[model samples]
Target: MKLDSAGLQVLSPAECVELLASTPIGRVVFTDHALPAVQPVNFVLDGTTVVMRTTPGSKLAVAARNTVVAFETDEFDPETGTGWSVTAIGYARAVTDPVETERLAHLSGAPWSPDGNDRFIVMPIRQVSGRRVRVRP
Candidate 1:
């Protein structure tokens, strides 16, 4: 855990995970055709692992599997100049195991896409870093 009072406050690993899980949507960054790409995902945090569903033919399905990826979510207020951002970096893997997929499916909000939200991708949180700033007075 690290802290800075003036410019930004560095959050602990636990705080980062908690903040990451509090949000319902996040952006996932991965490689697409060797070029970097970022896709928004409706995700749920399951004990520090981020889970989301994607269609079989979608680029996310093909591009994110078995790769190191970045997941991020944040909120801010323009008037206050205060907010927090947390990022999680880890290796992603498709959850082909039926039991685990079924288990994670019950965690939270329904996926934004159709196709029954069947394809599950899991990113186990390896490293989390975040910063928070105070409101301007």
Candidate 2:
């Protein structure tokens, strides 16, 4: 097992991608009026791209357009102190092409909230890293 300076198990790039695919929800960090903001969003991994759905005029939809964003997802077992976290950084863009949008719509079945949240925000996984808490020996 590989460990980082903080004593956490270092996860490989492939591992990180796997973890990202295993989870359904993640937090997206983006710049909001020159300040940092984070929002929990439902996402899916599409060949190394983080895909999320939001309303067309929503804050996230606006802020993430052609902007660099940080996405993160993780799971933990607090009782045993075992868990893993994955973070991916990339530029996000809204899906404007009609054909592409239609294709992505079928990726995840049923939107979490079907209230006019049909726009797709895609963030390609350009840089990713992950870490796992060291399980007790």
Candidate 3:
């Protein structure tokens, strides 16, 4: 097993995406009230875009107002001493087109609030990067 100065092996982009796709929950980071805010969201990888659902008054409504946002996802297996993380920086927009709304609705993200919201947001990544760490005993 090979290790870096930090004592872990680094993973490639393909590896990172593979790990990311293994899970459906990710963090959306954006500036809110002049500070960075992150929220856990349920998302699906639609080609290169990340699609999720949110309520009307949610923080996403504010963060996404700037059009640019950072989204990330990760997973790890402690028992195996391995993990990976993927981050995407992109432009986010509310999907309002009837065709897009219908298409996104078919994807798997459920509302996080009790108000039964049906709004869909799409984040189209302009740049994507990721890393993985593995500690071999």
Stronger candidate by TM-score (1 vs 2)? 2
Give the per-residue lDDT of model 3 (tens digit) for 1-137. Answer: 34457765555656656666778899998888888889998888887778877767788865675478888987778789877778888889886666676667676544232343666778877877776666553
Candidate 1 wrongly placed segments (more than 4 Å): 1-6, 109-117, 133-137
What CA RMSD would candidate 2 show?
2.9
- Measured with C-alpha atoms, the lDDT of residue 96 in candidate 1 is 78
lDDT of 1 by residue, 96-131 (tens): 776666677666545333335578899999999899
TM-score of each: 0.84, 0.90, 0.78
Output the number of the TM-score-best candidate: 2
What C-alpha lDDT does candidate 2 achieve relative to the native structure? Answer: 0.87
Angstrom error at residue 115, model 3: 9.5
Which runs of model 2 end up more than 4 angstroms from their true locations?
111-116, 134-137
Please identify which of the two predictions, 1 or 2, would achieve the higher lDDT against the true structure. 2
Candidate 2, residue 19: how far the Cα is off, in Å: 0.6
Q: What is the C-alpha lDDT of each candidate?
A: 0.84, 0.87, 0.74
Q: Where does candidate 2 have its weakest 10-residue lDDT segment? A: 108-117
